[model samples]
Target: METEELQAALESAGLSQYQSDAYVAVLELGKASAVEIADACSVPQARIYDVLRDLETDGYIETYEQDSLHARANDPGDVLANIRGQAATLAAAAEEIEERWERPPVDDHMVSIVNRFETVLDRARTLVAEAENEVQIALSPAEFEELRPALAAAHDNDAVVKVSIHAADESDLPDDDALSGTVTQMRHRTLPSPFLALVDRTQACFAPQAHSVNQYGVLVDDYSLTYVFHWFFLTSLWEVWDVIVSERSEDPPILYTNIRQCVRDIEPLLADGATIEVSVRGYETGTGVRQNVSGTITEATYAGVSTASGEHIPLAQLAGQVSLHLADGDEDWTIGGWGAFVEDVEATRITVESIQYE
Candidate 1:
């Protein structure tokens, strides 16, 4: 390297500019009077003596009574090692900057454990904003408001957004008008609960309840693991809660938060020979390939329901298994919910886009 560049590198290794310059000069001269170092580098004659003394004290050079007090570069083993270590550190930092500049690829492990709840929440914001089919979240009222903008953006993109606000009382509930256009359905639970956000049925961000003994978070990018979190969201955080805001339509083109709700509403319609033309957004069960399918609902099947007696069935009753037979053009597909192990497709959002009387 050039002398100026080498001197700058030495300065970066914790040397003052004058000390670096004087040391480089002594190393070049082998043994030089203080006047020689000051002449070779930018160190002024007035400061050359003090600079050489400081360099010798730090072992970068040794001063001796040679003719008129000369400084010779020391063995330089330690100084070279220190400079090399600093260069390595700088190189590693540059690589890190480049790596972090781009979006990181999802790791092969699918699940990442982290220390802070905010990490999961921040990732949830990005996932929610990009959600294609569905977004499920359970958080405190304040967190709901914090994520509201991203939720609203997802909702605007026609994604199904269901949120459960936990640890909230009547006073913590957001005004209904404030919730409009931001969520498909919102429920409020007065008890504390863990934070969770599941997006598109494939990714989940989860954290333990704040009062838990050990606080941490789990971020999942795998379909199966995310399905587990999805059910936790349904059973533990959402199903039992009372609706605070529901943007569902009671008329045609009805929107269902999930496949179970859609099946419950459409079972009677199919029984009455009403052809349900629906559009569904979800992924294939076996391949995890996502698609939007528009077809006729030929049949609806689920356990724990009595269509013969017209008895009212709660959604939890049919949670064990629910599937719909969809006839699209010349093909037929069986659609299931959240985690469909046996069916062809796992429907995340089902809409009664249009219906016809057969």
Candidate 2:
């Protein structure tokens, strides 16, 4: 496989563009010199060595030292086996991670009951560092001061920051005048607990009511419960829910946790004749195997779905088996779930990136 075919095949096996080029070049030339390989691959000769080094590291190429270094493609069969082994290793790790964290694949989660104050602060800082998009926190002014570095890093990472000080005035901060400006928005309010932090509106850590002031905190990344935390603090207790400070020009995809709810949500727009893009990831109940798919939603009903490949399965069959990512732009409504509900699913999620949703 040379040119497009070779490139596609190498890419499918997880080779970088340059690595694919170099590997194919080496294989094609058969025992070629570095310059010859570079020339064949159309890669800069000076840069070829680095690419070759990476390829060798990945077991895609074998290098020999002589008057000048020479290289050859690793045996195709051996490389294939290596790919299989690497893939299996990755899958096993993913399974272990999934076993520990089955909700939305969030990286760092602190769901522990620690009596020590240091443990609480450490976990809160960890959550801040792991935040990828937005950080919505409800804490005292003092607590905010303590987590300043973590919050600053989150802000610098371009995450939208929302801070609600529970019973503390923003103006009365003993320090952090400069850091205060970095907060996208600040509000003052009262809360039931001493400390509460929510990141990306998807995960939260709240100090449960206890005899001690900040006795222990419970962290949760589960979608089922985070909404309550947001509503309780951002809406009920604190009162200001305006995240008017826009993080992105476009809103993030609305994540629907349940299959039936998603079906109901999309029911009204049936007349729009929208070609939906749906991505699904879930477990095949029968095989106990996980699957993932993201593509156009061709057929759907209250019970199950047909997506990406025009195949449909019943809901009870995949009960609690799927998660959906949906966006209805001007022309189409895109939905995505893991393999449990869709077909031809891949590890790398595909989306309706072509359309812009307002």
Candidate 3:
């Protein structure tokens, strides 16, 4: 590259014109006095001293006063590295300021436009995967047609897809050809809402009424706001028209069983010293009863229960007081007619032996 181009590049990288010229001159002359540098670089003698001071401060050049002003350019590698480092620092500081100002509010609703039909489909697939329990979708025939592939993808991943459409037929939608069987588990429903879909009780998106027969539409992903929309649709819209709906299971029994197992695993981790307030519903009474108690290794106390019968009792004393019986197979095992137990010293499972009403 020419000297002028190199000078321009250096200046663009944040070196002053004089500093760039002086450094180029130094590179050519090997080493030079301030007056010689100024003459070679076409910089004014008065400004040469200021330019040298800046170069020295930036570690781009070394200066020595040996009876006269003496200056030499540092390594070219070192100069470029320092300039790059300074630029990065400025960029990082700007990013932090931008992030603070651009932070999103928790309650704010956000709308984004997806011009491509495929992008909208991908987003819907992502929403289905993130859904915890339920999913609901309302789409026009054209948009629903585009979502067939996305629906199959969701089904392949074991997601329960519940779709509502305005005019699409159930037989027309895509079927799972890989298994040589149709996607029979999809829930199909009919909705009058002029939009595409709602998923996970959180996100909702709408197809443009203009492109309800062809192109893509505006997609909204805010959950809290969509709940309000759902409420309005259920109350105001559902009262007027006859809505057709269908539902199918993904893995109903496995889902419920997994939830029960999770509760069982977490129960033991609720240690002896832990206090929990539980509202339990009885099978026979069919009413939820609230109970709060603190349990320990040696004793359990029900301070929240004001009745005299609800007083605390030691682990060993619980056998007689609660009509406890030990299981024959396990020595440390016991059963109690009431809900109270010892920790590690003895484990007890409670059953509904009887309920006495005062």
lDDT: which is higher, 1 or 2? 1
Best by lDDT: 1
The Cα RMSD of model 1 versus the native structure comes to 8.5
Candidate 2 residue lDDT tens string, 59-150: 87889886887898877887888668877888899998855542223344434454555555666788887776667777666687788888
- The lowest-lDDT stretch of 10 consecutive residues in candidate 1 is 100-109
The alpha-carbon deviation from the true structure for residue 260 of candidate 3, after best TM-score superposition, in angstroms, is 28
Predictions in order: lDDT: 0.83, 0.59, 0.50
User: Which digits, one per residue and each the tens of the lDDT, describe model 1 over residues 1-358?
Assistant: 9988988888888999999888888888999888988999899999999999999889898899977889898897998888888889999999888555433446744787777777778888999999877898998878888898999999998998898988655887778766988998888888999889998877888888889999988888997888778778888888888987887888778877578878777777776778889888777877878877889988888877555544445766786888889999989989888767798888767879887785
What lDDT score goes with residue 100 in model 1?
59
Ranking by lDDT: 1, 2, 3
Which pairs clash in model 3? 138-196, 202-223
Q: Report the alpha-carbon TM-score of model 3 versus the true structure.
A: 0.42
Candidate 2, overall lDDT? 0.59
Clashes of each: 0, 20, 2
Cα error of candidate 1 at position 17, Å? 12
